[model samples]
Target: MAVLAQDGGLAFYGEPDEAREWFRADRIEDIYLRLAEAEEHEWAGRFGAAPAPAPGPAIGAFRQWVLLTRRSLDLLTRNRLTLAVLLGSPLMVLAMFAVLFRPGAFSPESPSPAATVMILFWIAFGGFFFGLTYGLLQICNELPVLRRERLTGLRITPYVLAKATVLLPLLAVVDALMLGVLRALDRLPAMGWGTYGELFVTLLLCSLAALALGLLVSAAVTDPAQATMALPMLCFPQVLFVGAILPVPVMAAPGRWLSCAMSNRWAFEGLGHSLGVERLWATGRSPLGPPLLDSYGDTFSRAPVVDWAMLGGFTALFLVGACLVLTRRT
Candidate 1:
C-alpha cells in the first residue's frame, strides 16, 4: 500500500494511483468517507491534548436561566403595543381615581372611609392587573417553541423564572409610577417617604403574586385567546371578594373563604395599613368613618408584614403551580 499525504499532515493509506483514480472517478461516497475519517482524526487529536470538561448541572442551569431571561426581556421590549398598554393602563386608572376621590379622603380631620377603601382597592388591583396582563400571554405564545426546547434540556423552572425575572422589574416600575402618579395627582395622601416606601413594597409584592398566578394560568392554557378569556374570570373574583366592594366579614362563608385566596385582599389591607387608613378613619369626623370601620372590622389593623408574608406565599404557590404545569405539558 502507498500512503498519500495531504497538506495538513493527514494521510490516506491506499495505492497512490488508486487514490487519485478514486478522486477522479466522481465517487462521492469514497470522497466523503475519506474526508470524514480525516476530520474525525483531526478532532481526536485536538481533543486529546486537553479535553474540556462538561459543564455541571448548576452552571448549565445558570447559563440557561440567563439566556432565557435575556430572550424574554428582548421579546418584552420589542412589543411596543403591549408595553404601551401595560404602562398606560395604570396611568389611566390613576387619573380616573384622582378625579373620583377628593384630596382629603384619608386626612385625619375629615377622612372619607369610602374614598380610602376605593383608593387602596384600586391601587392594589392596579398592581395585580399590571402583573396579570404582563404574564397572561407569556407561556401560551411560546408553547410550541418551549416544547421543542424542553426536549433539548430546557427546564420548566428556568423558563417560568425567566418570565418572572424579566417582567418583575417592569412591574416594579409600573407600581412606582402608579404610586407617584397617584400622589402627584392628589389621589394619595401626603406622607413621609418611609410610609410611601412601605406602600410601594406592598404593591410590588401584590404584583409579583399576581404575575405568578398569571404565569400559572398561562402555562395551563392552550392559546392566547383562552388566557384572554381567563382575564375577566380572574379579575372579577379578585374585584368582588377583596373586601373593598363587600367586606369579607359580610360575605357568605364561601365568598369569605374565596376572598382569602385573592392576593389583592392582602394587598389592599397592606396598603391601607401602611397608609394609616384605619387610624385616619377611626378618629376622623366623617360620619361614615365609624360605621365603615365597623364593617371592615380591623381589616387594616394587622401589620403590613403579615400581608407581605401572605403575598409572598401566594407568589410561591402560583410559581410552583406554573412550573408543574409546564413540566407536565412539556
Candidate 2:
C-alpha cells in the first residue's frame, strides 16, 4: 500500500492492478471501515480537546476592568506629546483670555457684561475642548488592538469606562488649574468655597459630557485623521449655538432648537447662573448689562441642578452611543 496525503487525510494511491491485489472485494469494506475509524481517532487526538473553563462572570469582569484601565493609563502616561498638549493648550487659552478681559469683569459692583460673558464662555468651553481633545484620538488610534482583544472576550462597557477612568481625573486637574490660574490672575472674582465647588462640579460635568462625545466620535470614525477632522465640526456648533456668541433668544427658530442640544449651552448657562451673571449684568453699572440680560432672556434663570441633570443626560447619551458603535464594529 502506498500512503498519500490528500485533503488533510491519509489516502491509498497506487496503480489499478496494485490496488486490486492489495484488497480483494470481500475485505474492502472492512479495510475502509478501519481506515475511517483511524482517521477519526487521529482528528480527535489533534483537535477535539475540551476548552479551558472560563472564570466566573463577576471575577472576570473585575479583572478585565482593572487590566484595561491600567493599560489605558499606561498608554496615556507614555504619550508625552499628547499629555503635554492636553495640559498646555488649556493654560494657553486661559492666558490669552486673561489678557483679553479686564480684571473684575464679573464682579457685582462693576461688571463688564462683555467680559463676564466671555469669561463664562471660556470656562465652560475650555473644559469641553480639553475633554474632546483627550478622548478624540483615544479609540481610533488603538482600534486594531481593541479588535484583537475583543476576540478574547473584551466588553465594550469596561473598555469605554477604562478610557474615561484614566482621563477624568486628568480632566479635573486641568479644570482646577484653569480656575485657579484665572482666579490668581484676578480675571475671575473670588467666591466662597461653596460657590467655587458648585462651579467646579459644573465644569467637571461639562468635561465628562464632552469626553463622552469625543469617545463616541472616536469609536464611529475609522481613523484618528477622521476624528481630528471632526473636532472642529463638533466644536463649532458648541461655540456658536451655546448662546455665548449669539444669545439663544436672538437665534432663528431652528437655531434656537439646535442650541438646546448643545451641552455647552447648558454648562454656559449653569456657570452664568451660578456666578450671578443675570443679577450682575441686569443690575450692574454697565449700560450694556441690561440689554445683554434682555437678550439672554431667562437663559440663566433656571437652577444649576437643571443644567447638571442635562449635562449628566448628555454624558449618558454619548457613552451609550460609544458602546453601541464599538459593539457593532468589534
User: Evaluated with TM-score, which candidate comes out highest?
Assistant: 2
Task: Name model 1 segments beyond 4 Å from true.
Answer: 1-59
**After best superposition, candidate 2 residue 88: deviation in angstroms?**
1.9
RMSD of each: 8.8, 10.0
Q: What is candidate 2's lDDT per residue for 23-50, written digit by digit as tens?
A: 4424544445544556444533432343
Question: What's the lDDT of the predicted structure labeled candidate 1?
Answer: 0.84
Off-target runs (Cα >4 Å) in candidate 2 are: 1-59
Tens digit of lDDT per residue, candidate 1, span 53-171? 45445447778899999998888789899888877877787777777777867778777888788888988998999899888999999999999988668988888999999989888
- Superposed on all Cα atoms, model 2 deviates from the true structure by an RMSD in Å of 10.0
lDDT of 1 at 309: 99
Give lDDT: candidate 1, residue 311. Answer: 99
Model 2 alpha-carbon miss at residue 52, Å: 9.1
